[model samples]
Target: MKLYRHALSGHSHRAHLFLSLIGQPFELVDVDLAARAHKQPEFLKLNPFGQVPVLVDGDTVITDSNAILVYLSKKHGKTDWLPETPREAANVQRWLSVAAGDIAFGPAAARLVTVFAAPIDAEAAIARAHVVLKRMDDTLADSAWIAGSQPTIADVALYSYTARAPEGFVDLQDYAHVRAWLARIEALPGFVEFQRTPVGLTA
Candidate 1:
């Protein structure tokens, strides 16, 4: 398998993390975002949207961060990462939605402003980060993992951006359970971490 991605991209990191956890032997092909390599015609063949974190496994190609997580979990991961029961599967799906929606728009967006100089509303993103963190913290109040008992792709999906939320100037100090959840994720075997970019509060 070959993974094309940028080093500092949380989306890319999530894909990398899951593949590592699943013990998938893969090659990393870094995309030169500064050279606009993603927009080039050659790169567009892999992902028409010209995005990072495109995974090519033999003839199969998967794009989008969360989608990559689901694909890897289904194919490479043993039953632990994605549950078989209908309710457990649906519950994991719900957190995947949160990763795509809230985590994407919240901490992920906020970090983009500081780290990538993206033109987004930082204050609004930070506010959304706090809201989602509170919800996650409350959810973790009784559970060790996000979806249910065992750690799933849902936890992997949310881990990168939420762990780096402080880099966006969105503090995680207040959400104790969320912080604890992050710690728990980090302790998982074969876990890979997102590289920290010194920006915003992290600067």
Candidate 2:
């Protein structure tokens, strides 16, 4: 398997982290975002969207971080990461949606401004980050994991951005539960650390 990714991208980290957690042997192919490598013809052929974190497994090529998670979990028969039961599956999907939506626009967007100099509303992104962080903290108060008692792709989906929310100037100090959850994930076997870039408030 080959993962085309950029180090600073949380989306890329999620896919990379999961592949490691599952004990999968894969090669990392770094896409030079600064050089616009992902937007070039060769990379665009893999994903017309011209995004980082495209996973290639033999003849199958998967795009989107959450889609990559689903493909890997189902292909590897890691039902523990992706439950088959209707209710459990729905629960996991719910969090995946949050990861793509709120999390994307929130902490992830804020970080984009600082890390990549993206033209986004940093203040609004930070505000949105707090809203989603509070929701995560509240949800985690009653459940060990975002989807349920065990860690799932949902956890992986939310991990990278949330763990580094501080880089976006979205403080994690108030969200005790979320902080604890991050610690729990770090202690898990095969866990890989997301590369951190000091920026925003941390700068």
Candidate 3:
């Protein structure tokens, strides 16, 4: 398997973390976002959306970080991680949606603004982040993981950017549950530290 990813992308980091956790053997092919390599014709053939973290398993090419997580967890993870029941599956999907939707637009976007020095509406991003964070805090108030007691792909999907949200200027100080959750995820076996790049890269 080959993973086309940018070193600075949180989305890419999720896949890298999952692969490492599962002890999956794969090749890492760096995608030079600095050179706009992902937007070029060759890279687009791998993913029309022109994004990093594209996974190529032999002839099957998968795009989207969450989609790749689902594929990988179903294929390589223990049944506990993916689950078999519909309600359990829905719980997983719910958090995955939060990770990909709210978290992506909120904390992730806010971080990008600061990291890239992009012209972002700071007030708007903060408001967006607060809404999501409040929801997360409330959701985690009575649960250990996003999808019940055990960690699942949903937790993996949100771990990277959400954990480093402070770097994006969305402080986690107010979200105690989130902070605890972050620590729990980090303590999992095979957990790997996220790679950090020199600041000022556009995502």
Best by lDDT: 2
Candidate 1 TM-score versus the reference: 0.98
Q: Write the per-residue lDDT of candidate 1 for residues 1-203, one digit (tens) a residue.
A: 99999999999999999889888999999999999999999999999999999999999999999899888877865678889899999999999999999999999999999989999999999999999999999999999999998899999999999999999999998999999999998998889889988887888
lDDT per residue for candidate 2 within 1-203, as digits (tens), equals 99999999999999999999999999999999999999999999999999989999999999999999999999999999999999999999999999999999999999999998999999999999999999999999998899998999999999999998989999999999999999999999999999989887787
Error of 1 at 94 (Å): 0.6
RMSD of 2: 0.6
Candidate 2 Cα outliers beyond 4 Å, as residue runs: none
State each model's CA lDDT, in order.
0.93, 0.96, 0.85
Model 1 lDDT-worst window of ten: 70-79
The candidate scoring highest on TM-score is 2
TM-score of each: 0.98, 0.99, 0.93
Separately for all candidates shown, the number of backbone clashes (residues 3 or more apart, or on different chains) is 0, 0, 0
Error of 3 at 173 (Å): 0.6
